[model samples]
Target: MNVDPAVPLACEPANQNAGTALQDPEQGALSADEYALFASVARVRRVYAGETLFHRGDLGTTMYVIAKGAIELDFGEDLIAKSLGPCEFFGELGLLIGDHARSADARAIDDGELLELRHEEFQRLVEIDPTLVSYFLRRAIMRVVFNEQSLIRRLRRRNQDLQSALDSLRATTQQLSRTEALVRRDELTGLYNRRGLLQHLRERHRNGATSGLGLLLIDCDQFKRINDEHGHLIGDRVLQGVANILRSVAGTNDIACRLGGDEFCLLVKAETREEVMRYAEFVIHTSHGLLQMPQLPPLICPMSIGACLVCAEGEWNDWYARADTALYRAKRQGGNRVEWQDNAPIPA
Candidate 1:
């Protein structure tokens, strides 16, 4: 949030060598009328060293013209101070403005003198000498415009920097979201892991919008027999086949997960017992095809599938128990078949 100090407008003071060119009575370039107006309408004041002519934030409508010796304008906030000697002018901006506050402090560096004109007296001089009023008015307005334009440029640069910071923050947030998704995914199967599945179910329950939710619990029949005969490497291949089968049968909205060791489950939407049975049959049939694949030669046993019609309002553990009970029954009925807890499959 640090910003470089701004360069002031060209109309502001610059280094200048003071001289006594206007010391003589007739040397100043004022007409007889202007001289009379200047003397009558202006007041003269003198200050000793370190004397304050005006303080910032003080209200006034007078502008001072430096007459003799040396004085300086100091802006404490900007840490700027500029010296003015004889015949140089400052604070003309106040004369053209109404009820103006000094933007900086004015103090004497040495014994100095200044000529000040109140706004009302200046207005009367303008009436008497309209051309002279026009001369100073144009210069005063140009100084104000230049200062304001410089401020605008600084503000625009600051706004651009803020926009760039916001864009970087948005990019960082997107990267974090992608990283979180990778953490939830199962590396081998590309399905949700058990932890991921539980998190998903909790979110769904908290939302209270889960309707027609269904659960399918599956087990590979005679899986231990295959591992005993062909070794564990071949057993891992059979588990991978089960993952593929679940992927094939899953609907777009369904969440399929491997719950470790020959057990898999699919969560889906199915309002009726018939719809749940159809999904269970699809999964069982797909898993049976894995036996034909060359890598699953030892995995010749069929899969057992059990399904439950989920009640969205009930606890998920109770619903899962129903599916487990159905899976136990299907396995007891001797492997490759579908069963349900609330409703049984029609005899074929």
Candidate 2:
């Protein structure tokens, strides 16, 4: 990045209209000889608004001191650059580097006047007054170094603050993820809980209630006998095994949940009654397989499943109750069969 030079002293309005006789540097703090040299060499020039004083890559053999108004700097298409008011000077970097061209384009933003100094005249002044040259050069170097150090410190602090913010964001995201999983899952079987399944049903209802909204309520046939024969621990394992079977057979958009005890439910968005039946058959056929236990004989766990298709006008409880009644009828007719509430005969 190129840094502009500090504004020149001759640019000050107080110094602008000073009579030629008093234009001598000695008129202020300068010695008589120094004032004579300053006055003799400096030339005043006027620039109008919208005028281009210089452009990037132009030779910078001379510098200007703004006497009045402002100069604007343009980097490119954008006016992101700044303006220099009266008493501000630019273009000294070219002189210091002995470069023939400028690094940026300079334009007059308003009608302005400048005191121009040729490279030769500036060099002559420096030669005659080493003390003045040394003082100005030291001040310039100190200002540049101090500004650089301050910028570095600010950047470092900002980077540290940004890193800390990112860490906090990451931690918060992890915690939310774990919480969401817990909210949607059944603690015992790791299947979806009743609340989660109901939430999914509501979402489906909002999406135009497409066909094949099949709901099934499954009840273990003679669950009380199983609990009496084996322990609740074994019964719990059986329930979990049932949940796993339902999860495997269900589609990605389907939901399987353990309502409570040995009762479970499934929700699927099927396009037709046949599609619903196909899934029901899979569940029935898969549940026939017995679960093995160390202390108990192979348990042939069977489920009586009843299914119903959801209609757009019906309430959520209406579909559930109809399916649940079908489930009871299936159990009454000797378990382990798929029944539909539409009076379609249970699959043989």
Candidate 3:
């Protein structure tokens, strides 16, 4: 095609006209000199608004130059789509690239004329102008540099986003752990409360590892009398004092709970009869401070304990009832003592 250098390089309403600035190297419209040199190989085509010119994954045999209106090239993989206006040429990479596959989808945003250049045509044009090889080489190097920089930016952003998500997840997990601990503990005595007691007992029983596990149910004998005589404040201090004593005497593997009111429970790991008796005696001996009435005058802190061995064959409630029965016997036979479900009694 003989393009007259004097004629303006512009597209007509229906199609592109030959002889334009696209072939003029002096014009800055083409980013590279190679585009102006090889663009002469292209033929004109007409496109309308909302018309699809090309798609990603299609065999890219030809490149397009927009002489009029606008065209959008959407990289199918990313939201970073680009819009090209007049005097801009696209798919010019056909001259330097060999894979010949479209990298993005190209659609017309408005009615316009385009110049389509095929790879074969570009090769023939290169033979006509031997310097075309040098221009194409320069453009290829520039494309490589631009693409590498773009990929690096995307990777850095992705890494930052991943780190942010992990940090949020870690914070959420820690908060849940704190909330769970608070829910299972008593606010007043800092011991496991009733809800904590039930959950622990149920889990222990379900595990079928109740061998050597023993239960000690404790109650503050004549507690109501102390609260009535010394006010609830003194009564609460007495309860906390008893809890401290039990906590101190209990083994590291054992669990202690306050079952509301003046009732408490201790689950111990004493394997033999002697071990169990030792725990019971130690609790009674150390709790003498509670029995002393600082303000109420000798009528305070007296407690009764019911002991029973935990059995895997029995349910949590059954073990509790047996221990409770032992407690009932200790209370019935006068308080301030321990009664074993096996009929053994601990000296107060």
Residues 1-348 of candidate 3: C-alpha lDDT, one tens digit per residue: 633343235433232432343343322134344445544665667789999987875766566667667898897555478787665666644434444456578999999877676767766765766434434434443443344346446656545533443354455445545655666788777788877777777677678667787888999988888888788888888788778877887777788888889999888897765677677777787777545536444334778998888776777687788889989999999988998886333334
**How many backbone clashes can be found in candidate 2?**
7
Q: For each candidate, what is the lDDT?
A: 0.66, 0.65, 0.67
lDDT of 2 at 46: 77
Candidate with top TM-score is 3
Strongest candidate by lDDT: 3
RMSD of each: 28.3, 27.3, 27.2
* Model 3, runs deviating above 4 Å: 1-156, 289-300, 343-348
- Candidate 1 per-residue C-alpha lDDT over 213-301 given as tens digits, one digit per residue, 9 for 90 to 100: 88999898889988898888888877877888788778887889988788889998788988888888777666667556775356445
State, as a TM-score between 0 and 1, how close model 2 is to the true structure: 0.51
Q: After superposition, how far is residue 340 of candidate 1 from its true place, in Å?
A: 1.0
Candidate 2 Cα deviation (angstroms), residue 238: 0.0
* Estimated TM-score for each candidate: 0.49, 0.51, 0.51
lDDT of 3 at 96: 40
Total backbone collisions for each predicted model: 0, 7, 1
